[model samples]
Target: MSSVDATPIGAGAKARGAGGRRPIGLLLVAAPVALVLGLIIWPVALSVFDTLTVHGPQGLEFSLEAYRFFFTDGFSLRNLWLTIRVAAICTVLLLVISLPIALYLRFSETRLAGYIQALALFPLFVPSILLAYALIRTLGPNGTVDTLLVAAGLPKMPTPYLTPWGPIIGLVWDNLPLTLLIVLAGLANVSRASIEAARDVGAGSLTILWHIILPRIRGTLLVAASFVILGLFSAFTLPYLLGPAAPEMMGPFMRRTIIEVDDPVQARTQAVVTFALCAVFALFYVRSVARSRREQTS
Candidate 1:
């Protein structure tokens, strides 16, 4: 009688099992992927095609006139520059403001941490339009702040309401919750044992943060920066309500081009250009995430 082999299943069998499940995973994701392709990818492709072509005597001739106008026009260049500047400033501010709050919440055992987090995330529940209106009421001319300043016999201070700083302030406030959350998520990877060990080795809080915490959370910081920059680039409501009329951010600039200037092609060009800029940061974020995963796995 031949004895039956009692060997356990090998790697090859495991591989076959995984391969069998691949189709099921793909099927699960197929619907959302199809929706993204239909809703986002198709519209974007059409916009790009529109920006690169024009209706001529020959009917739908290829042209770069829209892009040429964007690159050469002074007003368009100014708007683009203003958008970049505001987004950069807001990204920096978000990182600066969120990191400390995240650090405190990550290490503190106090009861107030929950309340502080709630307050920080309060803007998430408030509608952007309502926030813009509230900002206008509180920071606009003769609003709450100005009223209080006048009541105290202090000279009226310069408000950010209609200046470039307006959008910067609003964007920073609106994005703080997300930035803090990302940083906190990153902080979770920092083991208490490592921190305690560093403290035992005479490492101060600042030293531990610089040497250990910041290094571990660097990827998270990059992700937050990329997200903030992308959101600010495409932001409309706050910028529209708070920002200056001239040299508008790309969001308002695009809308004005379409509505007031009645140039859909030019507006599409602006959008494509904005998307290209955001894509660069998006690529950086992707690379950072990939590197982080590789490090974790290895």
Candidate 2:
């Protein structure tokens, strides 16, 4: 201590310590980032490679053979069509149901609106697999729903389980929360003054909805639709359990091709195709968000 070098040794030591720790800090940050990139990038790369390569006459070569086989042989086309059909129908039905609920929540001070909201959001907490099984138990043929119907002297309706409508029903229930939340958020941004002015001029409810509400909520609609479409395109669990064997959705088709048909390369190629379709909608969703942000800032 008496000899201390008398040159602000403590400050210099602290500076050197911080400099040493800098690389450690950087490593801590980079490690997770590297892991995430490795997880996402590697599988995607493998899928693309599988999609573009074929065991051709030359042992291995790049070609569109996989894609041609998928499209022309109608293996992928049928699944793609079914996926689109279910997704489209669910989207339309959700919009039809969610719109009035949103409008009611916007204007009403009633407790019923609160209960409706709680019920609508209930499915968010239920896992899809559990819900799938629960639906089969409650609504399947000879299950609780049919029993009740028969007891009431009404014939039991056809079992929706293991049918297209079965998955459709489950998907609609699961997707309701998504669509409702979007519609409510869009409704929140609507100017109360404009709505009031329209009402003061004797504009009917449907007219106000058409001329005022619909235009403002267009972006929200796009966001909701994109989310639903993306989800349905990759739908696995619900449709897998409830849907029929023949006209399967893309998710089941992909898995069946891998496990049953023993075609990992083809399955991965199908996955690549599904993701590419989702990408188009994802780009539109991004653009819609960017435009909404710009409008708000401007």
Whole-model Cα lDDT of every candidate shown, in order: 0.86, 0.83
Over 1-298, each residue of candidate 2 has an lDDT whose tens digit, in order, gives 1111212223344445556656765565465557767997787998898789878787879899888888887757888888889989988888889888877877778999888888988999999999999999998989999999999999998999988999999999998887787778778877889999999999998999999989988888887788788888888999999998868999999999999999988898788888888999888787887787678669
Query: 208 in model 2: Cα distance from truth in Å?
Result: 0.5
Point out where model 1 deviates above 4 Å: 1-22, 56-59
What's the distance in Å from true for residue 226, model 2? 0.3
| Highest lDDT scorer | 1
Please give, for residues 1-298, the per-residue lDDT of candidate 1 as tens digits.
Answer: 0011111123234445456656765565566668889999999999999999989998999999889989999999999999999999899889999889988888888999888988988988888899898988998888899999999999887888999988888889898887887778788888999999999999998999999899988888888899789899999999999999998999999999899999888899999999999999999887886687578569
Model 2 Cα displacement at 202 (Å)? 1.3
Clashing pairs in 2: none
